[model samples]
Target chain A: MLDMIIDFFVIGAKIGLILLPLILAVAYTTYAERKIIGYMQMRLGPNRVGPKGWLQPIADVIKLLMKEVVVPSGSNKALFLLAPILFIAPSFAAWAVIPFDVELALANSDVGLLYILAMTSIAVYGVIIAGWASNSKYALLGSLRSASQIISYEIAMGFALVGVLMASGSMNLGEIVKAQDGGLLHWFWIPLLPLLVIYWVSGVAETNRAPFDLPEGESEIVAGFHVEYAGISFALFFLAEYANMILISVLTTLFFFGGWLNPFQGIPFVEEVTGWIPGIAWLLLKAGFFLFLMIWLRATFPRYRYDQIMRLGWKVFIPVTVVWLMILTFMIKAGVGPWFTGRGVL
Target chain B: MTVESVVFYLFATLTLVGAIGVITMRNAVQAVLCLVLTFFSAAVLWMLLEAEFLAVTLVLVYVGAVMVLFLFVVMMLDVDYASLKAGYTKYLPLGIITALALFGGIYWVIRSEVFGVEQMPEPAKHGADYSNVTELGRLLYTDYFFAFEVAGVILLVAIVAAISLTFRGRRDRRGQSVPMQHQASKEERLRVVSMESGPRQDGQEKTEKKKRIRRKKGGGS
Candidate 1:
């Protein structure tokens, strides 16, 4: 009994380690996004709060927490309440599979990619429920768009990932990163260039960023699916979105950029030498790069028309990914290049 | 029973209850909700089976994508609750007879012993690797290569068929021009002509010069 109690605390602390950073990251990410977008727009953003608005996220958090959650009159009260939970749960659940470092992860399952993919896919429900439960047309429309967008993009994204899985031959993220040991050129991004590009673009679509963010196009849709959400209900959606952005970036790193692997090789104690820099920093840097790209796209491109977005995803992305998957399989079997020779190559 | 078995039974009960609710619910949307619940509980049961992959896939594919789409369509349709209730008394005897016949057949199959009730082979003594995904992949590629390839082809054909069907009944005069849309380029869409304002400036072109500068600045932003 005593041993079991001790194990419980250990397990809890382990879980807390994963959860706490994510919460903090989600908070700071909002600040980073605002600051980055602020610079892009040539405006000083959130400069009033602590030190160039560094503490602005905290103030926002406090305000959200203090605000009263107003349930709409006609909404399905039970499901309305459950929607945010459903939305938030999958975001947290997905963190379990991400290998921050080789040894540091909440749940280092062999099927880590699949698990993350599965959890992320499940996140659609939160949007759907939030849309439906609001009993509002705008909410419903937003949800419908989100469901279709995510579902379509997810298929293309999965196929793109299949190319990576084909190259690496392991869903284990640690192993995938280890395979990219030699240098950046040897990374899966080189041989699987088509996949990398497809994955990146589809990932943008998956996260509803920029041109693909038609669901929440402010001018037309009026905040899209979460239009009815306010106060803490709205805040959950906000948290989920940024967390997902982080998740997508982390996945991109693990899949393509060699998660936590030192870029320059043969340096004595490379990972150890960088003890001053935490492993989480590399992961964050990669995720931040993708996040920045997402923001940049948002700032630059106009939103895609609904039909056009669907056509691009289904017609162009899915087919291209499918063809590339076939070519990758054939190349691997036929022993075409260095990828075939090196078992260690990711 | 062990704690695991007890938990298993609880999920099993939830699954059965949800399944029953799916059939009995008068409201079509409520029926769909029950169906969603059934899918969720069934996924939980898959978790009990030690098949996390299948469980998660069930949730991801079925609950996440398929059922939500179902709900969207079902709720939007003007399903007549009165019409659903109208046939209840009239069709009761016929429905009962059909259901009884199906149940009897299922019971006969269970008792026939054609399929043994033997337990699954015990997992390897080394314990679970959680790497069953890799093993499944190896088997699919090597041992079942032909079957796997055939399945892929079938799926591809189905996708092609679905897209073709979607395009079949289009009567709109301005139907989307696939080839023309594909051929469209930025240069064609936005034309640039150079015209001197007063003197021949170094960058006198309006759109072209502006575009060149915009493109370069756009690179960083």
Candidate 2:
């Protein structure tokens, strides 16, 4: 009993170690987004708080925490409160199986990738509940759009991952990374380029980020589902969105760019020189790059129209992924490339 | 009780609660949420049985996609709870009889000699390295291959049927053709009608005069 109690505490500490940094990273991602977008627009962003706006997220957190949580009179109080928790919990829970190093995962389950997919799929409920519980038409409309959009993209996303599964022949995230062990060319991104693009784009749509952010269609619906949410309740939604952004970035890195594997692994002198840097650092750097790419996309493109977003998800991306999946099936069957040569029947 | 039994009971109780909530909740949205809760608890029970693939897939497919769509429809509906409740007392006797019959049927099945714990002993636990997914996959591909293919075919047919039922390719509706829009050129949209650079014509002057008179009248009003 004493040993079990100690183990529980140890696990709690480990979880805190992962989540604390993740939360901080999420906070900074907002700062990075603002600054990056600011630069693109030729303006300064939130630089008044501290040096280079280093303390901006902290200040924002304090402000949000101090504000009153104003639940609307017409809202369902139980579900209204429950929505934010549901929205945020899955983003955090999915982090458990994300392998930062060789043996640094919380739970190295065989179905880690599927677990993450399941967790992300569950997040739609948060949006739906928030919209419905608020008793607002705009909120309901926003959530309806969001739920449908997410479901549509999820199919494409699942197909894209099927390409990865065929390549690596493993559902275990750690094994998937290990399969891409030799060098940068061995990475799944090289062979599965279309799927990578589809996955990332679907991920953006899944998170309701621009240019696929018609759910919030600020001009059309005025902040969408969380319009009635205030203060900490609203902050929770904000946090969940940012956390999911980071989560997608990390997942993209893990699935395509090779999680925690050195990009210069097989290169001659560069590998020797860069080998001293830890695996976690490489993972973080790659994830950060993807995060910047997401922000860059936000700055570069206009928000997609509602119908256009749907069309892209269903007509364009789904077909592309399906075709790629068929091509992948042939390649795996014929034993063509480094990725497909030694794989057993999927 | 042991830890496993404790966990089992905890989830089992939650499952029962959620099932009860599904029937008892007044609000339609709340009732759907309770149904989701019931599904979730049952998924957890499946997880306890080491059927992780099925459990996660249940959450992913049904609780995630299907339930969200269900909630979407339920929220959109403008239900009249008062009208629904009006017939409750009128049908109470029939409802009670059906409920008791269901209860009795389930009880008889469980209490029968052929269906006791002794008849179906607990499954042996597997080691950490044993992957149920691989085992399940092998079985699915070999033994259940034809059934799986049939299921896939059925789903495809259903999808086609649904699309045929709802899809209307109305030419007169004037929906945006995105490909055409993307193909649009500056020349097509902007008619740069070239003419000699000259002073305004008599018609332009007349229009300007009319605009000025209208503006003057509006200001006076």
Candidate 3:
């Protein structure tokens, strides 16, 4: 019993540790997005807040909390209320498998990558339920569109991940990073560049970001599935979207960009200098770059037409990933690559 | 009671209650939600059995993708509560008999000496890094290759069958070509045909006047 009590305390502490940083990440992600996007548009974004909008996320949170949550008259009461919590829970829960540094993950399970994928897959439920519970036509349509979009892109994403799995020879996130410890060439991205690209696109679609964000096009659907949501409810959906983006960025770094490893590990002097920086810094640098790219893509690309986005995912992305997956399998089996050192290579 | 036992009991109860809810819920959507609940609870139980990969996959595939589709269909369905319950009494006897036969078969299998506890003992606790995924993959590839291949073929056939059944291309309908659209200049959409403006044709006007006169004459008669 005492052991169990200690176990609970340890678990709580770990969760609190992760959540504190994560919540801060989610909060600042919005600020970074606005500032970055603002610079792109040649404007100062929210400078009126605490020192160049650094504290804007906190102000927004307070404002959202102060607002009233208005449930629609015809809405399904119970499910409507449950939707936001459901959306936000899995977004944070998937963080358990993410190795911040070498021994930093809460649950360093055997199937870490798979766990992240599964947790992400389950997030669509909250969106579907939220849209359905809203009892609004626009909400229903938006949710359906978003649900189908996420599901379709997830296939391409999964195939792209198969390339990572083949290269690393393990589903464990730490093992995957460890496989790429030697250098830039050792990273899976060198050979699996196409898969990496597809993975990024899939990540964009999965989060319903710009270009693939036809589901929630403010002009068309008036903010999509969460159109009816207000106050903290709306804020939760917003947080979940950004959290998923961060999650995707982190996964991208871990899989293809060699998470927590210096960019020039093979170069003797470069490696020595860069290695002095902590592993967590490299990991953050890679993930932040991807996150910045996400915002960059949002600001650069026009919203893709609905059918066009669907066609890209199904016709283009899926087939490419599938063929690449087969090629990767053969490559691993034949032991042709220098990177296939962990297993099946001479 | 020990902690593990207590946890197991909690999961067991959740699964049982969810299963019951699946059948008893009057709303079809509610029933589908209950089914999802049951699937997830079963996954939790699988975790207790130290099959974490299987558990997560179950939650991922069944509760995530399959149940979403199920919910989509159920939500779209126009269900009448009275009509749904109408078949209950009519099928009660047959349902009871079939259920009993199924229960008896399961009972026989469980009670058989061939399938005793000695045949399949509990798995020993593994270390922190014992990957169930790798173990399962190795087993599937080596000892059960043929079975795995057969299953893959069956699933592929099912996919083909589903696509063949539903996929109908309507060539009559026009579809946009993105390149064609982009390459399209003002010349394609707008054609300039310089022509003199002619006076309005009086033929249609005369016909209209004649029809009006005839109608007036007919009304007079």
> What's chain A's TM-score in each predicted model?
0.93, 0.98, 0.97
TM-score of chain B of 2: 0.80
The residue-by-residue lDDT of candidate 1 on A38-113, one tens digit each, is 8989998789998888899999999998898988889988778888888888888888878887677777677777
Interface RMS deviation of candidate 2 = 1.8
Stretches > 4 Å off in candidate 1:
A1-9, A267-278, A334-338, A343-346, B1-10, B24-27, B110-126, B138-167, B171-173, B176-221
Sort by lDDT, best first.
Answer: 2, 3, 1
Q: List the residue pairs that clash in candidate 1.
A: none
Which predicted model would earn the best TM-score?
A: 2
- Model 3, residue B189: displacement in angstroms? 2.7
Candidate that beats the other on DockQ, 2 or 3, i.e. the better one = 2
Chain B superposition TM-score per model: 0.66, 0.80, 0.76
True contacts kept of each: 0.50, 0.67, 0.56
**Which window of ten consecutive residues has the lowest lDDT sum in model 3 chain A?**
A337-346
What DockQ results for candidate 1?
0.31
> List-wise, what DockQ does each model earn?
0.31, 0.62, 0.43
**Ten residues in sequence with the least summed lDDT for candidate 3 chain B:** B196-205
Model 3 segments more than 4 A misplaced: A333-337, A341-346, B1-3, B111-120, B169-171, B177-186, B190-221
lDDT by residue for model 3 (A1-346), tens: 8887787788899999988887899999999999999999999888888887778999999999999999999998888988888788888899998888887778887788878888888898888888889999889889999999999998899889988987887888988998888888888898798999999999999999997897798888888899899999999999999989998999999999899888888897887777778888888999999999999999999999888888899999999988888888777767765677435543
